[model samples]
Target chain A: MCLSIPAKIISIEGENALVSISGMRMNASLSLLSNAKPGDFVLIHSGFSIEIIDREEAEKTLEIVRHIRPIK
Target chain B: MYPFEQYHSKALCQALVDQIHLMADRPLRFMEVCGGHTMAVRKYGIPSLLPDSIMLLSGPGCPVCVTSSLFIDQAIHLAAYDRMTICTFGDLLRVQGTNGSLEKAKTEGKDIRVVLSGLDALEIARQQPEKKIVLLGIGFETTAPTTAATILTARKEKISNFFVLSAHKLMPPAMEAIISEGIPINGYICPGHVTTITGIAMYKKIVENFGIGCVVSGFEPLDLLQTILMLVRQVKANQPKVEIQYSRAVKPEGNPKAMAIIEEVFETVDEWWRGLGILKASGLKPRDSFQDFDASEVFSLPVYEISEPEACICGDILKGLKKPQDCMLYGKNCTPDNPVGACMVSSEGSCQTHYNYAGIN
Candidate 1:
């Protein structure tokens, strides 16, 4: 099983985008999801945007990370 | 549904546990040689799921973990310049050397900047001509070509302020060193990102020379489990081979254009890894034509001698001789907040993996 976090696309480029999650902005890819736009939530994997995650799933993941408190 | 959530389909983890159970009698030792694999394996509690007889070992797959002390010292030297802007990835900022970390220097009012890519560093140099912009180039083959491309772009655009302190390393050479040193690795879960660039065919020589079963696996749990299963099959059949499970991203012949760009700008040379010692032809050096972009030569700094923290087992950890918990100062003395060792500092490091997910006790 894989744990992919959902992040909102804050901005876009040709094949990449700047995504935000829990107020942290990181470079994410938009190659896999052509329909993804700003305000869309995407599942980021190894710096690549894998899929467009639903808002509910994104909220659940945020809850889990908040509970787990991963990273320092 | 995600494979882990399926009722009828057993979790890939459970399948892996079952395989480990079957192979427990033989005392199998499989090494996942990617930092991402190390994190995933520990994050999902893969070790606890398996039988004790089947030991999962980690290797020197972490590019940040494998980078030598001298490289860090060079970075510190470059950052000391009055008008220098040293740009690097976030991970390198925390890796502690003899004196201190790049972050510590930055905190002490150095102009060390954390950048995501060489492109970012190039942009900084392009924008500011009065300041010398030096990018601390770190990573294996997967990241080298990108940096190489940036260097070529700098030359084309005639950006004199841009330079790079290259610490780029290759993987297969290090793998060969580990095997030759008798690390007792029965099988290997190869790095998917490196394989995506080098391809499964690049590992053909290793399998032939060492008779080790290898499978190129993705970063996900299913990908790891499938690769493990494939390794088990190879061992059971008495046929050591290399297999590719991440076909979606990797091809036999990887991106030739990227390889060409790398060849155009850099040359393979002898290099030192943090724990692996000096490995021949395992490092990238800027081509003779690109000498103007070489930071080390331009600065004329003396050979830097950096010492490690006493009681830190980062060297052993990188060599697969010990785990993060096995280190005397893993969670207690060295931590993500105040890292005493390099492994704890880098996100794609074994000690960081343990500290982040496996330090439940």
Candidate 2:
């Protein structure tokens, strides 16, 4: 039941927002987020934006992941 | 390849396994309470990657798998009524109720639709204005907010006939249920998406009370390996605390907006689970004002004691007290095609996960 995906918000309308994952656009409720404006990356669960992921933290995690060296 | 594939690199996974081996002083038991995580662990063959000393247990995370018989019977009863259509998630179709399963009812002529989300039920209601559309709302915090939103939508649009048979649940109480049973779980790989809605800090009380290390983890292969290594290190250090391994999605302070939305439509109440008995304040009930949307109040049915399938040990399996292999029905009579238990019905369920990935073990 905890399945979620990170989607970028493209538009905001009252308590709902439009987000794009890959190329598909879906409407998500913003009742759980106060500042997930357009262009922000938010973690979406069951048609609701639950968390606004920090860009710097996401980059840092990605950087660390890119540096992964296989154990021989 | 997907960007996340780097974490699945054989070298990276091997390195993480080596790190866990180095940090571990003795055998450790870890429980993953989310069905998604259970799927990830099995999909990646994570158990085989680790030392046999590290045992991973699956907990009561799947909503369909953990749904109580009473709730299912009520849903079945609601679906059987004339001029009513029952909408539910795909996983709930095969779950057994008192008479049988919704699938059986569907084959016997019932309007049971597998909806992608709660809002889809609203759409169904919009199309079939003549029928009563009862959405079988069942899930955890991750899903309650969606139902709450649908309730607001239904109220605003005056979408009559669109009612919710809410059997939603909470996760922390189930964790407490397992802990209270003295299951001896050393650490937890908390559900990734659940923590996003609830935040990583909510598990602090669990750590404080039980002294078990809890870390909110993402579902990626690297995320799982990283969190498992963190748990092993915590176990080695004897420092049990709640940590956030999936910080990118989870915040220390969870989304207040979502919780507020949920409160607008529902309230916490004592709920009964499939394996676990009635847990206090573990389920959601529609507010008194919204009783029109409650199926229990809408449908009148006789109450009787619930009896599970004779030989299934799903209760013990859900509590981590026994593995799927421990059940005599695991593969013999309990195949996924014709499931005798809830655990075998859901893809995220422990029994199904084990049976699909690491068969017989």
Candidate 3:
């Protein structure tokens, strides 16, 4: 249950949200989530949206990737 | 396609290997404390990418693997009662209890249901209102809140038929236990999902106490490799601190609502790990307010003292003292099909991961 994947919320229907990972879509319970909206990336674990991905943190990982240079 | 190939492409992995070769010098051992990380590292052949100087160790990460046999025995005793259905994750079925495994019980006409989530068990309870439904809630922080939320729902709906035998554990205590024993671990690849709930800041205590580098990373291959790079650099610079490589999912503060929900339904209790003896306040039990929803409290269970196979060496494996290969029974008698040790039972277990990726002979 620890294994989680980042999925984008395609639509919100009450407490359940239809999240898409790549192109595959599945409905996850957002009962624990407070105010997650569509287009936000959430960490899906065991059919529950545990955490919404932070944009700045996503950029930080990208920043690290940009800094990495191939060694000689 | 499963996706995320852009981050795990062969070209990117090759470059990461080259970068490690240029950067690394002396030998280092890093223990990945999550089963998910262990599977990812072995599945992607990440070990082959690194120089021989670097080592990766797997800890007691799998909840199914580390759950004390007494817990399983208790579940089996519950299953024996007529008009009772035991719900659990698929990983818990083949686990051997004091007398026999859950699969064996199922074969003997016991109703054991494998569920995807704690809510699924609640659903079963709702459908079969007459039967006593017990969800075997076993996991780390990642799963406890989900079970908690389900129990709260059951209480609100006035459903007394549902109860949870919670076997959830916290990660930091186990980390502290390992470090205190002088395991010689240089750094830790902290669990991403657990950190997502508890936050990266919670690990500061461990880093401060042990003076070892602790970092969180995602499951993607590039993310794991990048964290390894960060860990090695920390060792080289003699800078030991907590960092988050998986900041996208994990923040410094963590998910407050999730943590609050876990606090609502369950409280920390002394938990017995399969290999490691009972760690203080390491496990979660139902709070007194939610006593009616606790399966163990509602129903009496007899605990059994079951020792692991003498030759298994799972205890040493969990403590990071011995690799799966170090055990004589690793492949010869402890195959996943017929697991003598708990470590060989789950897909995330180091032995199972190694056996699946590279043929264990």
Error of 1 at B290 (Å): 1.2
Q: For each candidate, report its DockQ versus the true two-chain complex.
A: 0.06, 0.47, 0.59
> Cα lDDT for residue B166, model 2?
88
User: lDDT tens string, model 2, A1-72?
Assistant: 667877888999998898998778898878767887898888777677778877766556656655645444
- 1 or 2: which has the higher TM-score? 2
Residue B236 CA displacement from its true place in model 2, Å: 1.6
TM-score for each candidate, following the candidate numbering = 0.82, 0.93, 0.96
- Identify the superior model by DockQ, candidate 1 or candidate 3: 3
Give the alpha carbon lDDT tens digit for every residue of A1-72 in model 3.
Answer: 498888999999998999999899898889878989999888888779999988766666755675778665
Model 2, runs deviating above 4 Å: A10-18, A25-27, A62-72, B1-5
Candidate 3, residue B166: lDDT: 90
Q: What is the DockQ of candidate 1?
A: 0.06
lDDT of 1 by residue, A1-72 (tens): 022455778899887799987788898755434477998766565455545544453244223223422222
Model 2: docking quality category:
acceptable
lDDT of 3 by residue, B50-137 (tens): 9999998988888888888898899999998879999999988988876788989999999999998888899999998999999999
Model 3: which residue pairs collide? none
Against the true structure, whose TM-score is highest? Answer: 3
- At residue B89, candidate 2 shows an lDDT of 88
- For residues B1-361, write the lDDT of model 1, one tens digit per residue: 2222221224434655566467556668899878878888887676776666667888888877877677877888878887999998887888876788888889989999987767789889999999999998877767777678788889999999999899898888988888998889889888876765566777888899999988887665656665776787788888999887655445566656657778999999999887788899999989889989999778876687757789988888887898888887878878888778888887768888888887724
Least lDDT summed over 10 consecutive residues: which range in candidate 3 chain B? B1-10
Candidate 1 has a TM-score of 0.82
